[model samples]
Target chain A: MAGEVESIEKFLDEYMPSAELKEVKRLLYGKEIRLLEFPAEAEELAKEKDFELKGYGCDAARESSRLPKIVRIAGVQNKIVLPTSAPVAEQRDAIWAKISEIIRCAAICGVNILCLQEAWTMPFAFCTREKKPWAEFAESAERGPTTKFLQQLAQQYNMVIVSPILERDEDHGDILANTAVIISNTGDVMGKTCKNHIPRVGDFNESTYYMEGNTGHRVFQTQFGKIAVNICYGRHHPQNWMMYGVNGAEIVFNPSATVGALSEPLWPIEARNAAIANSYFVCGINRVGTETFPNEFTSGDGKPAHKDFGHFYGSSYVAAPDGSRTPGLSRTRDGIIIAEVDLNLCRQVKDHWGFRMTQRLDLYAEELADVNKPSWKPNIIN
Target chain B: MAGEVESIEKFLDEYMPSAELKEVKRLLYGKEIRLLEFPAEAEELAKEKDFELKGYGCDAARESSRLPKIVRIAGVQNKIVLPTSAPVAEQRDAIWAKISEIIRCAAICGVNILCLQEAWTMPFAFCTREKKPWAEFAESAERGPTTKFLQQLAQQYNMVIVSPILERDEDHGDILANTAVIISNTGDVMGKTCKNHIPRVGDFNESTYYMEGNTGHRVFQTQFGKIAVNICYGRHHPQNWMMYGVNGAEIVFNPSATVGALSEPLWPIEARNAAIANSYFVCGINRVGTETFPNEFTSGDGKPAHKDFGHFYGSSYVAAPDGSRTPGLSRTRDGIIIAEVDLNLCRQVKDHWGFRMTQRLDLYAEELADVNKPSWKPNIIN
Candidate 1:
């Protein structure tokens, strides 16, 4: 793995200035600006690197001639097609192997920040009502093997990795949370943001296993950009998305594992609204494929009992600050969506549309303070 | 118009138990149940009524055999297809005549609560940047001619009418606000909810004319159902929608005057998200057709100067608490959409989803109270 990382680095360092890179850059910048081309040996080296450099594109924006900055982001929406009812350890191993391949692919494509779907290490088994099999999947945020693997990749590629996992807080007596751990380019654990809103609808009885996030909306000042993670159900809460923008997040990632029946229509709405309302880029990721449990469950809609929790449609896409979005990745297959975003677009959009400047935070603060009161009123009838 | 209203009442009285009405009812309730029908003279009364009932659909759900209450809500998305540069009075009269016809149409369809688009009596001329012509469109929400006319219609049909108007709040020194006057079935003023969020983008430079609402989120308790209006720009704010639900709004209407390029993508997202997140029915209405102002305006997108504000794309639709949504109205024409929604679904969904019960409101209140503070921190890294 270490050797693979070095080869990937060598290929990237060599391929950074090729004519192919320039064409991709031109397509993004909208004008042809000459970029120096690397030697032919770099192409040969990439071929020999054993790293699949699939789907590469570059987007750059220059606020000024000298202040050019770009943030390349990737969303990995994977399917859990492993053998059904496999042992927990075997399931973990199979998932890890698939994730490693995608991470390598993202690194080869020069992604500065990469994000995985919520609880990426395990099947979404909380819906089964059989708690033990799923609870056994929870791991420490700091010492988890998933984190260790992501850290290695993050350091090797000088990339920031957002890994959402089922966290067992050993220090807090094994209290669980749907946590997103940020791994810095230096292979250090930057921090974690917990899932703020837990859905209890139908088969999404996530509260049966984990509690609502104790950590407030935390924006990580990573090497590439300022980023935040609004894990899964938090997307439905506007305030949850607003706080991240309030804390100055340039990009927010929503890593989710929601089924199609429960959230497909909502899938296109929430994250895109968050991006437009907050004036920031949003990368929406979802787990794909169907997962069947040992026992059947009913959705309370008077439907027949079913062992599967519907499809986890993986139509992951990136929405820009200007409310434009990219085409989603495959909904039934494992895939990676890489979007090249100009972080300056966040500033440009904020300036053009003064949603932040004109939000009237004071009014909302006063109103929100009164919402939970016993005698709260929505408005003055008089 | 009074004759039209009386004719509708006679028709409804006669058709209550007709076989045609039974088929529609059975299609909605998902089971065949006999319902008493109106006399045959009702069909003769409709023939003499001289009105057209546009698009209509029935959707109903009953949790049990006993709890059966249905609310039929209609959203009128009218276009200002009158001469674009007509006199202010002429424009007002023309718009009123068109809306009156739609009201009659809605009444004939047996709509219980009828909501018109934002400022339905006036052309959305804030984009023109010409003050006097647009300013003249403002009227007193309590006693304006539009309200008086709607009151008459409300009384004649026994319908709750939601009329969004550009309000001239004379008591407050002629200060203006985007106000929705809720007229009760008995021809009295129920109350008014002002638009809380005002847009300052491009042609939607509404802040220049009106201040943000001080009325906050007001839910009107009418005979048909408890309802609320979030008005146009407020739709982008999730808290705005949530507050109405908190105040026990079974149905929330978003009366809007937005354009295609600016908000078409968002049109489908916000109201549906509101319905699902708040577990209430959301009816979204927008004015139709394109308006050409006298002068050109720039949206800062580096495009050429344009006189028109693009298409309004009047795709009004309704979303249920169960996340199902009706298709939008016509994008290029004036239209009315009637949706038959079971108010019981709101409660049934809340019971199943438990979003309201499980929401950590205290945590959010504390967090929201700090957002405006200068020393607010998203999270403590240590």
Candidate 2:
């Protein structure tokens, strides 16, 4: 029996090559399986450019362009306990120190445009539905310490920084908004676009904190490329991605903080869809690790009280215009994923696919005009 | 040295289980890995219900609902040579016969809703750019021979059929449009939706044959469920999928005939995105095999002359609202993929995800209203 089993095992090994078996495991386990890694090239380029690259490939085809406008984009996913027991000021400082370290790492990696996870200044504590203390976390989008910290790094590295923050609009009677502040490479603040969509699922309770964004889809033309931030919940809205595309965004960054049980399956689908549907590049960033609050919270489902908001399985990835993607970052660790993207691919893909030329916007506008009307009805039988 | 290598190999094998190694290979190769298959359950149900079920697992969860609205949907991907040398009438007969054989197999599968590939009645000869002979493929949407043939099968099997056809609008000077004729289980005509987005890339030259569809995003109310058809190129449009969701479609069928090189990568992404974005089921179907035309066609890319329009690589699959999907059908051969879907999951997901309730359509409408005006800009710097 032992001999027979050994022979069967040998036959299996012969039938399925070890290399093929390893790839299958990567798919089944949904682990970080790198398709292309050019550590030697990155190391060489970093030394020449005086900027370190923690080692990632540059997917630029030489023959595809006469003058390629290539840019390295980095999305950082970090997780840390806010130390709610500490003073609010100390808590803020600790969070900033942690994120700045990550940003410093991104700078060493030679990222031209760096994006931090959504609302990086504070913990995702809105699930508690406690207002007074959480409201204290919101600050001025421009004058906030978070902005000041990112601005210093942006200017030092001469790189663009997209910092998603919970903004306290002081001029507008202290109304709060989820906003992404775009800082130019010159360390000057560009414009900011507030998150258009606010999630109301389970423990989100985002509507309690801020109303829908007043800012429409805004694209910022930075030194590296034309970019926009589709902050967190806005990723679910296809029209949000479309408007950015219509506005000529070459790359859109979706910085998010979602849990594993809530949206892990969808994390891989939407950004890639945006990249393909809009004929552009997408850098999807998510926060990592599990944060347990002081009090237990219910997910609104028929489940027992849970201490944490499920796992924030960070799988930050970059989706290219050609429907190719970088291997996602580790699900339970802090990391930055760097991808060298040629902005020209946006135009090439659009021309090759003709998605923009063929998209029927006029037809959609007419249909949308009826959405707010009382006489409007979807083709529903029930 | 050989003994040392063998010891190292044994250690590596022990470290990485053979089962995991096998899964990794499947991912790397992107093989047809079945995520769901339940032939025995389907066979048993078919015996009791007077219909046969081609063994495929259904995504419906029994405990999730008191009365689960579980419906088995089938998407048929077919490939048949048109025999252009023969009389066009004989060519039509041969194609219909081949498709009917596939449809009969679908009936055995106890599929509640069955969808055929896009423009399945004739060869995809639009590449030749010869309108004189290809226009002959167009027939009346309501009184078309394809609709008549499908009506017979739909009634006999008590299944709803979505048949995409090249329609000749007899009411308007015999104008042509890409349309999907919806046949009810009782053999009644359940209205039709036209293909809104038309591809004009390379040899597609679809604009030469038919104009863009004007039917709007119309969801057909069938006996089985509320469904809509996003014919071929229309799948590329996110708003096209959104409007259907706005109008309340539970399932959207994207019947496509695209070559492998042109869109094989996107084939898996878009429909799955639609399912996740809209919180609905997407049954994406595509035609298979390569058909060599009498004349060689250039794809306008300055490439060598090619007699075939690349391989279709049929990989029809169904994506559920929970972001899970069935393994796609064979890429090289014609086949049918069946999936059992619990329609109630759509509402469950919407409630959990809150994508619909949270989507700020009003904000988008305000932005889209500026699309035609000169004052509009998408935050572009250059």
lDDT tens per residue, model 2, B3-45: 1121112333445456654432222222222333444654454
- How close to the true structure is residue B290 of candidate 2, measured as C-alpha lDDT? 78
Model 2's number of clashes is 18
lDDT of 1 by residue, A191-279 (tens): 99899988888888788888888888888998888999999888877778888888889889999998765666567777887898888
Cα lDDT tens digits, model 1, B264-355, are 66677678878887889999998877788777777656888888887787778788776667656666666777887778888877887676
Q: What does the interface RMSD come to for each candidate?
A: 14.3, 7.8
Q: What is the docking quality class of candidate 1?
A: incorrect
TM-score of 2: 0.87
What shift in Å separates residue A57 of candidate 1 from its native position after superposition?
6.7
Per-residue lDDT for B207 in model 1? 84
